[model samples]
Target: MTSPPPHVAVSNYKGGVGKTSLAQGLTVAAAEAGDRVLVIDMDAQGNLTRRLRAPLSPNPDERFGASLADVLQRPAKGEIERILVPCGYGGIYSERISVAPTHFDLELLARTAGQAASERRLLRALAGVTDDFDLVVIDTPPRLFCHLIDIAWTASDVILMPCEGEYEAVEAARRVKERVLEDRHTLNPDLEIAGMVVSRYRSNLTLHKQRAKEMEKIVGAEGICPTRLPELVAFKNMSEKALPIVECGSEGRHMASLYRDVYKWSRDRINTVMKGAA
Candidate 1:
């Protein structure tokens, strides 16, 4: 018997913590590792969707087709799968990563989100297609309050917060944990903080090193990922080009390796939790 695919939400209340970038990298890494991955762009900005559609030059303002907002407004079971846009770029994986792209209308979804019948709208939609993939990565908006974030947390098995080694980043991670705990007690008891990744880390800086150590203590050693992702210009360039950092070029190899290691660690963590539950 096969267990349902794990839903991992790459989330942080703080913006510009490289949250979307990390989400994109992890999805690409998972796909290359032979997991059929689905990226759900829950951000109203649509950065994840735009990056994934890059090189193809999608119009950011236009609603190309059915988007996340559309699904949330009328979340019928299996409707999420119908909006999946195939990533045309093929390299490391035999199967291309698929994304449920979002458009500007998602901003509308965020504004009038309370109109939705249930906070579990996303959970119900995803449940219909759990057997189709090994993993589902949700790129949530950078804010803590909102129905969209609620939906993401409700649907997710593990919430991975990618924090930079900075004071604001650390505080943001703490707030996210508090929010998740609130949701767990009141809404979704199954949700867990699988782990937190210290992203864009600089080894030589005392501040960065100290913050990573502190986060490890807060989340426990196992909850903090071993590999620290370095800051790289290639990440931004790859996003602009609509390509995964791993597929960008030789310059991005090192960064990609770090992200891949984190992805593997996350996979192991989820499997361990699932086994314990079994």
Candidate 2:
């Protein structure tokens, strides 16, 4: 019997585009829906780590006790539970949600000159662990590096590309799709794009609306999520409080609704992909 593929990864090569926020929202939504979920911080900036209060390090070698870096180096010995930090809301710490914390060491790994077979490190590290959770959403870095490529090609069964509904962002999505196809042909043959999501949308802005239409043309209407997240202050508030929007109170209700849409869309995509594979 074959194991199930991990849920998906929210990734893009552009920074400051709400990648981490989307990851957190999806993880929280899934957990709240009673699915065991794990969020992996794969960026060197460690925004996710800081948000969850995970351990940090000034140097690569001195980071968290167990991290994605450690798992890459020793998959057989590394366990997700060892590195995972539980993020609770209203004093809740259930098995529904966990985070595989990372640190600056990720950048060190990316910069290493002689890192042979590094492209497959993440794949090996995550082996034998997909079955442990209902989903494992990875927050990839904003640049193309060994770690990003490795996770994109090896670990990701589905890719969720988030855009800001701008021409530049749409162009970036095109490039990302091309890269995904290229990687699938060579490394991970089963990889597929789950869909595209428009974040920070403002219907009052003609430019934003036009760009959204253009993006739908590029990725297809069905490939684009129907629920576009409006530009709201609530998201920023969630970030400030270091909590998922769902747990942030009545002010966060809008953000929580957006997360529910994402959770439903992602679940449908995963089910579709699984059915196709079967």
- lDDT against the true structure, per candidate, is 0.80, 0.72
lDDT for each residue of candidate 2 in 84-165, tens digit (9 for 90 to 100): 7666453443456677777766665655435675665666666666667778888888765455556545767787878897
lDDT by residue (1-278, candidate 1, tens digit) is 78788888998989989999989889888877778888898887888887877222355434544677778776788778877777656654436588888766776655565564567888777766868788989999988878778878888888888999999988889888888877676557888888898888889999999999888866788889898888778877777887778666776887788778989999998777656645
Q: Each model's TM-score, in the order given?
A: 0.91, 0.89
RMSD in Å for all candidates = 2.5, 2.6
Clashing pairs in 1: none
Question: What lDDT would candidate 1 get against the real structure?
Answer: 0.80
After best superposition, candidate 1 residue 175: deviation in angstroms?
0.6
RMSD of 1: 2.5
